[model samples]
Target: MRKLFATAFSLWAATAAQAENCQIIGNQTLCDDGVSGQRIGNTTYWNDGSSSQQVGRFTYNSDGTSSQQIGNHTYYSDGTSSQTIGTTTYFSDGRSCRRIGNQISCD
Candidate 1:
């Protein structure tokens, strides 16, 4: 009887630990302590643990596309983003580029 009780307690403890480790919502996993950040669909949400500070949010689209947002800046999956200079076009394979005249070339 004592051995059975010990085994049951151990099993319960292990199950509780696993439950507290991580949580899955939709296609994302959210850590309880916020150390792993929150995932939504194909995107992940991260914060600096500051209410007034800006954080990065990434979203991956189904059509081989993704996006990143930080503060007022928005980045696309093609490695491009909206900058103060102008609209930047990035290659599909993660290469940086800038629009020169009317064409997009690597920067």
Candidate 2:
């Protein structure tokens, strides 16, 4: 869940319609999206007071749930999953986002 959340957040922030600059400072990554993240060991802590730990292909959330990524597909412990095809990602719940150049459009 955390991996998906983090990846989705970063990906969206990076490719949003409005240009955003991202920079890495030490172990932390800061972006114009107002979200900052620091990676310590396998755990990633965010400025929004959330964190996740990565173990192998799995990312464990603070709430005890987990998600795993195998290839371009991510599977959640709750039985949900998402798949990415090219620059487009499709979620099990029917949400999807597609990136074209530096812009991303989602629905």
Instruction: Look at candidate 2 and tell me the lDDT of residue 48.
Output: 72
TM-score of 2: 0.60
lDDT against the true structure, per candidate, is: 0.31, 0.61
* The 10-residue segment with the lowest total lDDT in model 2: 10-19
- Tens digits of per-residue lDDT, candidate 2, 15-37, equal 24343445555567666567667
Q: Please estimate how well model 2 matches the true structure, expressed as its whole-model Cα lDDT.
A: 0.61
Provide the lowest-lDDT 10-residue window in model 1.
4-13
Candidate 1 regions exceeding 4 Å error are: 1-56, 83-107
User: TM-score for every candidate vs. truth?
Assistant: 0.25, 0.60
Q: Evaluate candidate 2 by giving its C-alpha RMSD to the native, one decimal.
A: 5.4
Q: Candidate 1, residues 29-81: lDDT per residue as tens digits?
A: 33354433333432344343311112235443333454555553445545545
